[model samples]
Target: MSPTPSHSASRLLILITAGFGLALGAQAASHDDEHASGAHGAASSQEEPKVIAKDSLKQKMAAGKAAAKAEKSDPKAEPTSVSMAELRDLIDQKIAEVRAKQAAAPAVKVVNKSPKPRAVAMSGQVKQSMAAYGAAAVPGLPAGHDLHWEYTGTAGPQSWGQLKPEFKTCSSGTRQSPIDIRDGIKVQLEPIQFDYRPTPFRVIDNGHTVQVNLDPGNNITVSGRRYELVQFHFHRPSEERINGRQYDMVAHLVHKDAQGRLAVVAVLLDQGKEHPMVQLVWNSLPLEKEIEQASPVMLDMNLMLPEQRQYYTYMGSLTTPPCTEGVLWLVLKQPATLSPYQLSVFSRLYANNARPVQSASGRMIKEGQ
Candidate 1:
């Protein structure tokens, strides 16, 4: 049936109003869905970056707060869109880059602080015994009680006797070494019978002088006693004098007998020819003091002696400690020549190792033929 115009209009208006309400509800729902998706994406992006950018935690937190404030101020603004997975990947990449940079940084250096090495000093049984024998005789010192002596200062030759009771003889002994041979008793004495042989030698810088220890082969007969050579050493500015004249250097060949008697032969050194043996010894000098160095090369003691074997004989004490008396001394009359260079080597080590001439004390010096 055909309806009236008013009825038709009312029905049409009702339909139109219902459709409009439905359309408005659909639009509101769509907006809500879009806002929810954007919020979820923003949360995911913020959380991933916070976890990955832990190295810059403070900066990330500040940026996230600023974005949240902007979103709150403009609710209708297209909710800031972000890809969660892409944000996570970017954060990880930045973290890896930061770690690589840290690893490539230069390392810190540490300085070493340690003490420097000191010079070596003489310490041996033979050296100790020799030092004890160097001074004037005294009450035997307690065993192993080593005393230190030097060329100058308090422990020098002048104060040796006072350094220890064992060195008393240095001050009281009548027959001392390095006497001035001003006037010798012109008696035809027996010549020194040298039985020196070629043998290996071990040298040592014993703080006082350069001492050479030889294999047991050399021997010398003086007066009625046969002495076996044990070792020899040097002293700068010949210890023994001839008519009050001092030479460049002197070598003392120390020897012992079956009865333990000591004998020393002094070969005075003068400035002249180059001595091969002296050069060898100087070349082999140890870099550090008190150290010993041995050579396999055979050395002949006779080669060190001068062609003229005439000598001056006397009863004296050891030039160095416990200046023990009764030592047989043979000071060669003619001096052996040593090149100036060789002399300088010894002088650098010991500028003046010679002890001053002791008082002759009315002792007789015999001149040998």
Candidate 2:
């Protein structure tokens, strides 16, 4: 029983590839080396071309890669004289000939005799989630289907919990964030020690808000714990309120400690004078969502804050979905100013992305004296 041409070609190609010490360089001298001053070399050179041509497209790609790598590593190696298009044309011609041979050959019939498997019932969790939201039934469903959630419409915050089982905390959590800072007990509280400095930043319009991710070294120390500043983002019509009054916008500076404990500093924004920090971030806004725009200039975090360090503090959850509680919220009392134009720029992108304030629920809030 003799092997087919395809099988024989594949085995020969494998053997050649395994001992691929010599490179197929671009220099004419390298091509000459293939047919060296020996009977053994001359015989190999004659059979090599036919065997290489019969190989599959995968092997051709591998050979092309090997040639490129050899040329790159060797300074004496000449640049590839052939273009990728020419190489592609040569490969296509060989493929067409192979296809023509197959087309001329007689076809054979083969049938599978395996029986069909039984149907499985859907789980109660997935069934409930799909029934509640009319979502697609797919494997590894967390709660709702893998549908993208939004700030408005059917996929908005109201339907966040029902949309996915994992986001159930968003609706069931008792200590959720962005609560109205009213009736807070005034007391002598430790001032949060800010250790911010000028650092390189990357701006991104992440579908929901304009977030600025900063380099390491910027952090804050409060209540005897030091939390590193991860990133900060802007929300229109501010999520949290001070004495029942909502500001124009808010900057949530999120931080985390070594143990993954979270702390958020809210810098409320109002329409007045132009803000240098806000303008710097807006300057680096990407043309499309999810695309990050890096800035050449460094940003000083101190410019983002107000002169008055007085703040109101409380324990709450994140303003967004999967509202996990235990977050330490520090809302700056004196609101920062951004010009009317600055406010309008953000409004155009996200007019109302702020979540409505949640219940204080007898949570004790501390107002810095």
Candidate 3:
């Protein structure tokens, strides 16, 4: 007998489901066999490890080490891929670049210790000290406290002795300047020789006094020796140690010999008519506030000479502080005349410019006589 259509379909579905179950069962059985084999191998290895003695195990380890060393020693074992030459070139290039960079860098420099700060501080202190004293207290000058232009009162020659310690001659020294020319002693007169020429002139207000610069061509010859005129200036009450006395006004003629010896000739000026030289200096005077340009005008050195060649000679020092010693002093016996106007001009500029007279100290005051 034949089955029905529905029963046939149902039978087909059951067959399909049974085949799928069978396939899954087969795969499980295969996996279990693989796991069992792995477990058996592990257990067998552990059971067999007791076969080796301790010494034998050590020997086996040594043999293994030796085998590793032999493999390392084998020349052809490792592939020769890395090139030593390439590595060395790369290292050398890096070293050269480092050296180049170092050379291009700036060199290290040291600084100098500057002295300007110390010098400025010291100068300030000196100025402060001078201000406190009122008058400038230079070493080796008269000690009078008052400041003057040239002569009289505080600026007079009499006060020089009390101004400073170094100017002791102001009181004690006997050979002083600006002495009155009383009577001329009879002496054989020699013609005064004058050698003057046109030369450049320079004038300066020197802060302390008016200094006239003379060129080298101007000179004076006395007793066959040549005395080069260096410079000439004015002093208030003259500072000449003649027979030990002081005068009203004086002109100092500074001369230097070839050997560098100094000789100063002082010409005393009395209150009288205006002298030609005085007028010349006053006419060319620059405006009070400004320094005028110096002109190359003819100056007659002879005009300042004494009418009577008679003179008093002595050895002395500069009356001014820093009183340089060893000066040959020659005070003319004759006096020059200066008008009140000329004297007033100088007084306007400097009322007390003269240094106080110094002591002669028994120095030999020789007369041409």
TM-score winner among the candidates? Answer: 1
Q: In model 3, where do residues sit more than 4 Å from their true spots?
A: 1-192, 198-200, 241-246, 288-292
Higher-lDDT candidate of 1 and 2: 2
lDDT tens per residue, model 1, 1-369: 233433433443344334433444444455555667665654444444333334344344344445545555774644231222233344455546645654654431111212222111222333444555431112222222355877788888999888788788888899988799867888787788999999887677767788776778999988778998877889998888899899899999888776667888899999999999877777677776555667658788999899998989889988887777888888889889999988888999899888888998989888876
- Which whole-number lDDT from 0 to 100 does residue 324 have in model 3? 42
User: What are the per-model numbers of colliding residue pairs?
Assistant: 10, 3, 27
lDDT of each: 0.71, 0.73, 0.56
Query: Using Cα atoms with residue i matched to residue i, what is each candidate's TM-score against the true structure?
Result: 0.62, 0.61, 0.49
Between candidates 1 and 3, name the one with more favorable lDDT: 1
Q: Is candidate 1 or 3 superior in TM-score? A: 1
Order of models, best lDDT first: 2, 1, 3
Per residue, candidate 3 scores C-alpha lDDT tens digits across 96-140 of 664665565454221233566777686655333232212122322
- Candidate 1 vs candidate 2: the TM-score winner is 1
Candidates 2 and 3: which is better by lDDT? 2
Q: Which consecutive 10 residues in model 3 have the weakest lDDT in total?
A: 79-88
